[model samples]
Target chain A: MIARLLSAFALAGFSPLLWADALTGDVQRQPLNVSAIAMFVAFVALTLGITYWASKRNTSTSAFYTAGGSITGFQNGLAIAGDYMSAASFLGISALVFTSGYDGLIYSIGFLVGWPIILFLIAERLRNLGKYTFADVASYRLGQTQIRTLSACGSLVVVAFYLIAQMVGAGKLIELLFGLDYHVAVVLVGILMVLYVLFGGMLATTWVQIIKAVLLLSGASFMAIMVLKHVNFDISTLFSEAIKVHPKGEAIMSPGGLVKDPISAFSLGLALMFGTAGLPHILMRFFTVSDAKEARKSVFYATGFIGYFYILTFIIGFGAILLVSTNPDFKDATGALLGGNNMAAVHLANAVGGSVFLGFISAVAFATILAVVSGLTLAGASAVSHDLYASVFRKGRVNDKDEMRVSKITTVALGILAIGLGILFEKQNIAFMVGLAFSIAASCNFPVLLLSMYWKNLTTRGAMIGGWLGLITAVVLMVLGPTIWVQILGHEKAIYPYEYPALFSILIAFAGIWFFSVTDKSKAAAGERALFFPQFVRSQTGLGSSGATAH
Target chain B: MHDLAYKRIEQSPQFKELVAKREKFAWILSAIMLGLYVVFILLIAFQPQLLGARISPDSSVTWGIPMGVGLIVSAFVLTGIYVQRANGEFDRLNQAILDEVKQ
Candidate 1:
């Protein structure tokens, strides 16, 4: 999925990347597809019904932030898969494979590898130690103000970049799918996501995600089956046909210069792996389950579902290459697929099924964006309310009512902010935005959160300075790197040569935190180190962790 | 009450055993996952041609495709293995430790 950003940057100028199916920046209105619109309306109606039911139970901060820890592991697994298998991964990887075959596999592998790492390293401890946001765990025994403030900042920055990327993609994808104005589509997503988080909170959002994940997986599975059926269910025949028809021929079977150097490849790998572990929304999923056992199960199921989904994407991509690319009806006058390469899966849906299946797939794409953005908004709101307002400003003394109120207000504000930024960045190339989000997450948030749970010597001074160092380094280096400096800013050459900066910045964060922490002899550092054992005991055994709310 | 519970569990052998066993399992699994990933990425970086080589020379699919798919499958299986142990054995140990601490 992160490797989708690699081709996204390459396809940055004329073809919008990830979820966008539009061929160009010009958003032309096509004949309105009544079936797509009808399915979308049905999805909206059903989710709103669930939201109405969820409102009654969302009285406590716990309910608002994590559905009162009431979610089962299986359900949480589906929701986590939903949060991850974005429309971008579905269409973008397929498009990548439809064009350059094996590289897409590499990208999907990068995306799936992160889930297992999260399961083995982070998931159980996170569920046991944290309450609302990850800041809860980071600030457990450290200086509550400094650590919480740093975490909130890191979370917000990642959230802002990620939201903007999703928003822009949603606007463009909806514009092409439903034939709506770009601004209208962006505003529609903004309003619906805000409604989901503001009223339904985590319970409503979870159900919405589950529904979308099921729809997406089923739709993709059907398409893949149809593709295999065309080749008599022989995978070798399917591959042979794809290799024969693909323009790149045998070259598509190997790496196609996606990363020219070892450094860039390793940097990108580091970002995708650790970035998934650091994501606020993904990490927040652990708290929705009842305990560490359910949390572990959640990762187990999530890894399976996500890996299955990626395998399906690979089949669908090769299927698209074999079926859709050669079909004259699916191509434009210029021989390019109508709309863009990202429409490979969409056209394949129509080629395999019909107009009706096409409508279903289109609607599922819109639903995927909505589900994803709602989760991001909730994570962002939690950063502001639970982490910053409750823990930092109120010093953990605020009533739950006040904290929940702040969360709702922050949700509305974030919705408006997302809508505005979506429209503002409509024409700008946003491939780097998601990459920047991942970089900051891997470099800044992952290091601090990981160290706090595992390391006894992670003092506030070390975490604060090192965390900001990584955050700023990731951003500045991104701007000075190839993607932005040369491509976006019209520069001759990049000052920072690498496109991905996680390799450098993550090391700096770890070393900086280690050096600062070991050098510090402050009384505060001693107190924090002294508290690590109790934290360790609870994290290991769930001794005093929050349990699921009783009915 | 909570601090006392933590202190009691911290001193107990059951807690130590739980931590040691779980930590070992977790680290070993993490290393395998990360090691496999690093090897895959390094192959992509250093030896693209080797990964591009056909599995049987007559097959249309290259070695990279199965290796990639294999990595994905292995990831799922590894998590399954971890969850199976953690939820069954380690979890029982954890609960027993908690009970002793409560006593």
Candidate 2:
């Protein structure tokens, strides 16, 4: 079915090519170099081989979905980094910092901080009750049907938003590098992503992510080092140079100089920070590990790796600022502003490091989009096949083959949907979509997970209400917020003042859970709630052994 | 298998003691997060001149950037605390849980 759909889409895209060519009067296009073609072929072969290997080993549903629950701490750690880093971290944030200066670093800081919270609070519990999806943990104490339904909603929301961002990024990169039409780029990315996830499942996704992370980090690190060398290895001097280059005596060292509004600055920070913990694709990686200790260790490694990556981005962004300020060509290029800030990092690497760096950075950027989209597809598949179909609709009776079939189908469907959205919203900023994903995740999923794990009095009623309220509040705020309303819809004055919605969603979710839990006595268990408080208290004081001995 | 693992951990005195300590630390960390979030919101709401006095416009130092840096630092510190605890106390607890599950 997916193959047929791809063929149809490809044909449609090609139909317009002849007309476009005739109108342009045969302008000679630059052909793909031998090296570029070879590299592209090699990447395809490696990814496909991994998928085939995973398919052969997946003897059961669990194996296909979660790698038979046997992943190691270090491997999962690398995979976590692979999964979370995405194109947004590798490209988007760097581009943001390159264009906006200090405000761009705020996004990096926000994402990096979520690891500690996950390690300290959520990791072990999630592993202990691990099923195929996050809803497994939330539903462990609640009714299966309720948890499954809510989990599906939350997962879908997150995956849809995240996938659109990645697809849009892929389209832009394809256009930039290969000169492909926008629709063609979208369809190509969608097909490739579906092939990766449908064939290999978790094992394939994990390996892809790990390989992408290594390449991405190494490539970015190399470029950053080279960039610093150009600056004569002077870290302090870069800041001074940046300060000297500013147009309006803008504060180079403060957030206030970056933007005019204080409220927007605070809201952006809040979205980035809290949104990391709530990301469904990220949390799902916890389940891929064998145990809780592994989960915790993975967080530690990911944090370290991610931290170093952010530091490198600082160099990359600042280097671009310096380079562009001096170069007439880059200064005249309006692509950065029109295409959005996400292109700044790539443009900088291309300009400063030459064609070799441009090709390498572009390849890594492509891989970044691929790895993240694959992860999102897997997460979405799990929510559909594992949570919704198997657990709720089929009562877990769906056999291994049937489950795999359903999951693959869902992956293809999702990929197509993502491609459609990407083309439709090509002009919009990918970061905005990413931020919306985070807001939805934090608002809808975080509260339910936190309350269920810690608050014993959290009844089924409370969980449902909290989850729905969070989902609704986040969606509404995002729709009415300035980014979508004023900027996208051209409504001069948006109803909601804030650009970020996580803060509002977080507040609404917490309030709903507390209010609902306090008033409902029938379903609430007082003793369980009391025990959780002490357990939480004890965990904080360094009393508990980190080792996950099955008590 | 699941019941046996649960029982083994529940029976271990060391595991019980560790759980208590971990819970305490969790509360403290949560409190810190809540407090930090409050201060962040306050700084955003009221942009005082004192906050920007030392941060020159030439360098891009504002209340928001410093506060963001602070959050990042604190997050790392908390992660370090978790690592120390895991290496020391939580290691034993996790081992106990694994041993029980394996048995």
Candidate 3:
């Protein structure tokens, strides 16, 4: 029965390869067989179908950007999961777990924790004040032109960094799965992503995210269950077995043993935790819901779903560690590591469930990349079309159709740029790129959003100075920091030794905002003061009666 | 109706109490988060072994599970506090503000 089951699985898995074999003479040379191609085609069709339906419904700019601002709390919540769970969540987290063990789970935790912060402090306010971009909220009291310019700059930096990271991962995955050249894969992904975003906008992006989220979560859940079944559902025994296999005498339960130094570990933790709230692409999802209540509920649901998914990742990662240790083929001819760290999850799937699960997981990972890239593209488009063009350059003269066209064009341009960068940076660590993006976003954008909502005396000059200062500080620190200056460029004696730049950038931004606010001449206007410090103050004090008005 | 609205606003003392409670909770939550973050760093530095035993045949304990669990728990706690406050207090006060602004 075992043999038959294995054989049946192999047949199901290899069927795609069999189909590909009939099309080309070079099929044997290609990395991807017929099955991967079939899967890719199917995903493309589904994505395009979504785009078509969304386009048909998109009669106005609001529909194109915010789905007519009528999406249910549940749907928006699911879409948030879709937006956040990129290739990084699926492949990146799994790979981290495979290599680092317990340390990998730390990244997942940092990411999941940020949602509550958003839910509590940012989500409702973001929905209530903003229409499309977060700039809407920040600029409500400040002048439009000032906030628009600052937000555009911040948005562009974040979107570009994120886009490059996704593209690089996509290119590498395509090369591994299809035997295509890295450049070709990058270009192919670029074209498809651009088409999806340009035609459909937010509507297409939302649906893509939802679909990918479902696929990824279901696949991870299934694999985790199967893995647990292998050990007869005994988690305690699983851990004990893992401990026995390690050559190192260190206890598997401990944290300090995983790394050689203490500082690196702390820095890594800081990067993961702070980076979660700083990401622009993720924050943009909050504006899609209708009201603050819906936004809050959506976040609640997202937190629960995302939390469970992370648990499953832990299982998958540990499963890989065991499966790879047993499999001889995983190692290279020289007995060194082969196939790179990112492929750990893929190899694990092959070992446990044969090719069927392997192919399915691979397909899901590819879809994950596509969905994230589409969202990033939409963000970039909005930065240019909405904030920079309409609010800044053209001063709101651009009509709806013209504005939409600009957005589409920007998406295509960014898509191409991402493809180019992806091919160039294929050899670099994807996590590093993601970290850099988070650092930039956190430094440049986060402070502005926070202060605008809470601080009544915040001035336009302070915001501009703070935003620019954050941007410059983060870029400069990252350039001179150990990660880029020494490691990437191969400098033996770099100026800074730390790997992550997030903490420093955040501090600089905060300080800049404070300093500028105190020194600037602009004063809070009467109307603005009221908006900044609402009548809710008395209610918050807990000394007032239960009435509609607080004052 | 306007007079009634004004009278109600003038007479109500619950708003003050609610605001005080919400602010107190916010401060507590903020402190807790700060403490947890510090602990997270400390655990990373000096007590990596605090996570749990390994699950694989190898001796390495998977940190991702513990960290992921910590984040999820923190998120839930924070969300719970926010929901309690928002539903209990902010909703009514916020409506009042909107009404005042319109007038």
Candidate 4:
């Protein structure tokens, strides 16, 4: 499928690479790179083969949603790691470290610390209770229609914000790396991701993610090892060299101006840690595993892989500062990197292993974006089909075939929506976009999902109202906050000063849910409370849980 | 399993034991992780210089570097411990409870 698409583009005499160069006055026009195109095409062909194989096994709705719960612990681990390690993290964090050293480590640490919390609190129960989406678990003991409606809205909002970030990042990165036109890159990513989900479903999406994870980990490991070898495996030498070459000098060794005040730091930390727990795509991965045991094991492996990846990224960043920043070949006439700081890791790949490695890393980076967006599209589609369409609209009367059709249609819809938004927000500062996604997940999804699982008194009314409260508060405060209001809206001062909305919104959510649940004395609330024990038993023991279908 | 089986399991001593032990264990481990993370964030928030302090006079490496790396390693190690115990001891108890109730 992708081979045909690429050939069509090639035969059309596409010249967006030259067009982009003409628009940007400083950047020189890069001739179409043969090696990068070859490597990327090869990757797409291999994944297309996997999608073909997976489609054969994707007969049932269960299979479409979760590979028939057939994935093993280790494979799911790699997929989870792949899904979490987006191109944004790979290029964005390395770029951050190259620009401001210690603060990048802080971001990496914030990202990894969320994994253990998810494993400890959510993973096993989620596997035991949910079928395809987190809404399954969130609505397990409550009013299915109401709770599913709320959860679906939460999922779509997070997915949309996250998709925009990934799409824009993918377009810009591909434009820089492969010298493709920006719009062509965006369309290609959208169509290809839709293919992975629309035909192959979760089965193929997981494989694509797993393959990308292995490639990215190996590529980063090579870069980090070569970097260490240059300084003879001495950490101090690497640090000393980085300090000498970096413009900030010793200031880069400590915390800089990236995060200014305490409130902002705490809020951002809260969002990163808890936001990870609430991400719809991450939660959906648990259902791909057969049982609670595999679910737990996957998180363990994912944590190790992700932690190791971030550490490697830290090394890659410092190495880029030491090697790429000093090289005249990597720099433009303005003394900055040709494509900007985000290209530090790419340039370092060339510096260490020449253009061949650069091409390989670039291909892996593009694959990383494709894999992540595919997973996000799958999760968002599940929210629509499994939660809203099947459970809410049909009132659980929908057949397997109809549910599956809705999800496929949703996948294409989401794919087109992502591409449209990607182009629409091309000029926007997307740094705060991911932060907003995390903040919403932290504020709305995490609070509702957590309280539903643990708090027996959580009535449907309470969960629905409180969830909306958190969602609204987060979006409103974010608009009024510094990043959007003062920076994006051209306002003089932010009504809400903090950059992150997680701290305040999360508090309001929890307090609202508590107050509402305690005050409700209705019969429906009583019935909801009565259902908690059965739900709790199923959540803990996996009794009568959906098992892996026999192939 | 039916509602009766769920009631039986809920009342069983082994089920209660598993729930109490596992919940206590998870919460404790989670507290340790979250507590450490809160402290790390606090240090970054309140006293950035403390984290920025050099480890030794001879090296350019700062205290913040090891501390950040330690948090990452700590997250991985703590999850390892939880998984080890959950898959072994907790699973054993859960199986026993299920077996008893299945009869």
Candidate 5:
């Protein structure tokens, strides 16, 4: 699942640290048997049908930006879950377990722990404040031009890196599932994602996500149930069987020294915990609801779905260890996995239920990639149009029609950029790419957004300077760190020792924000400070908040 | 109407109490979760053997399985607690505060 989700991040997780199968052996396979391709085509047809239906019904900026703010809590929850349980979670985690064992379990838990915090601290307040992009929240009372510029840069950067990773993952998955060329698969993903956003907008995107989420959860449940049935439905039997088949035996059941030191572990934890809160794609979901209460409810349901899904990944991972490792048909001539071990979960579907189930899981994985990329595209386009164009260039005076038109243009541009980068990064280790995205999100966006909500003295200059610093620090450290520095760039030793830099970069942001804001004696700073009261009240209680105003 | 509502809610003791209580509860839950996760991570970094230790003398199941499961379950339970409080106690308090202001 992680292979398919995290490193399947391959946009969901670009974490190379966890992806052993992603590293070596059979990098490509001949193809999935024919049933998989047929099922995938059917899934695409269904999404295109949804796009055609949604395009007519949604005609205004409000519809394009937020689906008229009418999505129900349960549906949004499903969409959020769909948005999250990417191909990375399905393939990556299973592959990790297939190779390393219990290490996959720790990764899954870290990914989940962020949700309760989002529910408690940010979700309701965000729903109350933002109109479309999360940048709407940050620039509410600050220097609109400066803040939006910084936020657009931050959002675009995160989305670009993440989109590339997902596209690459999509390429790999399509090649395995549909017998397509890698470049063709990437272009197909890019073009389809653009069509979803350009035509159907948020309404289509949300429904696609909802459908994908349902399919993914049901597929995971079917696989887990099938896996358990083999062991008489006893978890102990499953784990023991996995241990016996695994070469590492009992050692696979514990932490395999991945969190070797406190600093690295703490930094990684900070990235995962705060990164989700900062992710532009995730934050923009709040605006698709009517009120703060609905937003809060969305989080509640999302927490349940996401938490449940992670637990399923653990079951599926251990199941792969037990089932996939022992099966000869899934193995290669050299006894290695046929299409890389990241195919473990997909292969397990065939092992448990045969080719038909394999076809089903493969389709679900393809759907997962489509749903996530569409979400990313919408968020990126909003940062370009709503934040950069409407808010900054036109000073929020751009009409609804004009803004939506610009967003569509931005979507096509972003889609092209994503395809190009996907091809370039194909040979690169993308596992750390997701981690880099999270680090910037945690450092740059999270701090600025949180402080804007809570701190009274937060000035525009402070936020811009601090945010850019955070952004630069994260990028510089990422480039010089062990992953990119030593491994990717072929340096002998890393200038930055750790893989994650959120801990240091977050402090830099806070310090820059605090130092500049507190020292400012200018009239604008005082005015900005005064504006925080009304902003605070509105954020807390939704007093005088804008309605969707779409229809 | 909205400005008047904000002024009234800001002044009312009920609103004050609600805000304080909600904020305090949220921070506490967050703190507890952070503590639990930090402890787990610390154990992994400092004493992996503890998580590696078997659940019992005979079982192949290690302590990490339950601990990992427990952490996952802990997130679900904590979310459930938050939802229950939000839907029941917090909502009731919030409604009363708003109603008082509306009157």
Candidate 6:
């Protein structure tokens, strides 16, 4: 399918840049580059084929939601890694490393530490208990309709904030690769991702993710090795050269004030660590695997792959500083990077292995965006179709065929919503938007999910109220915080000082859950508490749990 | 696997021990990892110079480099240990309890 996509790209091959430049009314010094388009077309075709295959067989809600829970440990591991490493992580994180040096490592560490905690606390238990969503686990012993309602809100809110950042990043990547207008690229990418989920479902999404992961890991390794070779395999020389070229020099090796104060640091730390555990997309990946064992194994493999990838990113960033910084050809007439800092890794690819490799990396980067958006869209679709339509509105009376239709319809709605938001965000300064997504996931979803599993006294009223409180606090504080308030809103002093609201919002959620649950002496609360033991046993042992039935 | 069998297992002494051990172990590991990460954040937020201190006079390598690498390595190491226990001790005891109940 990727090859077919490449052929299509080749068909649109000539004068693509000329047309784009004409529309933008800007002429470029560089000529039209067909190789990059070829590589991008090539990569996407593979996923299109995977989507075709996954769509043909999957007709039921189970298959649509969790690939009928048949994905093996290793494949699921790659998919998890694929889902976690968004195009932002590929380009934006690398760009952070390229610009701020050690601050980037701090960011990567915040992401890496979350995986072990997921393995230790979540993976197995989450897999055993929940058939489709983590909301399943949270609602198992509580009021199903209310809990699912609360969590669906939480999930969709996360998907929206996260989807905006992803859409922007995807637009940027496609613009770089295909030379299409940014809005045009965003729509194309959005439509393509929707198709992947709308037809292919989880199975298609999973394979696309797996393919992207392999491509990314191999692409990064090739670049990193070539980088090391340039310095004659001497690590110290690479660091020393980086220090020389980087404007910040020794300061770049330190924190460099990217994480200004204590509250912000703590909140950012909490958001990054716990946020991974809360993300509906990440949580939903566990359902794709058959059992608890495969679930944990997938986490293990994902942790290793992600950890290794971050280390490579660290190298790639510094490597860019050493090579791309000094090279005049990579610079614009104004003497800055050609496409700003995020292009550092792409420039590094061109520097190390010439245009072919640059095309290869760019294609992989575009594929990375498509794969991630598909996963996010599927999670959003499931939140609507399964959690809302089947469980809430229909009260679980809906059959598989109708539920599958809801999912497909939701995918198209979300795709259009994403494109609309993508265009609207074009003029917005959403630098903190990614943090807001993480903040919401950490504050709202994490606290509810964790307390619901660990604390038996958690009533439905508590979960619902606490989750909304966390959600409200995160959104409000993020809006009032310095990034948006001072910068975007044109305000003087901000109401909230910290960049991240997770530390405080999380506390609010926990306190609310505790206060509400403890004070409730009602019969419903008693019944909810009584249900916890059965839920706990099923979560642990898989005894009488919802085992996967092949569709 | 009937509800009675599950209820019996849940009420058993061995099952109680397994639950206690696993949760305790997970909490401890989580605490350790979280604690280390918090310390790193503290150092970044407060004692920047300490993290900025050069590891050796001769080289450009700073404390943060090895520290960052060590933290990444630690994430992998901790995961390895958990997987080891899950595959070995935890799974074994879990199977034993299930087999005992079945018998």
Point to the candidate with the largest DockQ: 1
Greater DockQ among 2 and 5 belongs to: 5
Write down the lDDT that model 2 would get: 0.67
Model 6: colliding residue pairs: A1-A45, A1-A46, A2-A45, A2-A46, A6-A41
lDDT of 2 by residue, B38-73 (tens): 455344335434444545545444555456657766
lDDT rank order: 1, 4, 5, 6, 2, 3
A497-526 per-residue lDDT for model 6 (tens digits): 866688899899889888888998999999
Highest TM-score against the true fold, candidate: 1
Global local distance difference test of model 6: 0.81
- Please report, as a value between 0 and 1, the fraction of native contacts recovered by candidate 4: 0.70
lDDT of 2 at A66: 76
Rank order (by DockQ, best first): 1, 4, 6, 5, 3, 2
Stretches of model 5 off by over 4 angstroms after superposition = A1-16, A19-26, A259-265, A486-488, A548-551, B1-5, B99-103
What value does the lDDT take at residue A405 in candidate 4? 88
Isolated chain A TM-score, each model: 0.94, 0.84, 0.86, 0.92, 0.94, 0.92
Q: How do the residues A311-338 of candidate 5 rate in per-residue lDDT, one tens digit apiece?
A: 7877888888888888888888899887
How much does each candidate deviate from the true structure in C-alpha RMSD?
3.5, 9.5, 9.6, 8.2, 4.1, 8.3
Docking class of 3: acceptable
> Over the stretch A391-499, how does candidate 4's per-residue lDDT look in tens digits?
9999999899999889989998999899999999877777677778888998889998998889999998888888889999999999999878998899999999877
Q: Scored by Cα lDDT, where does model 5 land?
A: 0.82
Candidate 6, position A189, lDDT: 85
Tell me the lDDT of model 2 at A370.
80
Candidate 3 Cα misplacement greater than 4 A, ranges:
A1-30, A258-272, A334-338, A424-431, A487-492, A523-531, A534-551, B1-23, B40-71, B77-81, B84-103
Model 2 lDDT per residue over A132-232, tens place: 78787777657678878997899898888877767776776666655557687688778877887877778888888888889888888887887788768
Q: How many pairs of residues collide in each model? A: 0, 56, 47, 0, 35, 5
Q: Pick by lDDT: which candidate is best?
A: 1
Badly placed stretches (over 4 Å) of model 6 are: A1-32, A483-493, B42-47
Cα lDDT tens digits for candidate 1, A38-106: 999999999999999999998899999999999999999999999988887788888888888887777
Q: Tell me the lDDT of model 3 at A280.
A: 58
With candidate 3 superimposed using the best TM-score fit, by how many Å does residue A536's alpha carbon deviate from the native?
8.1
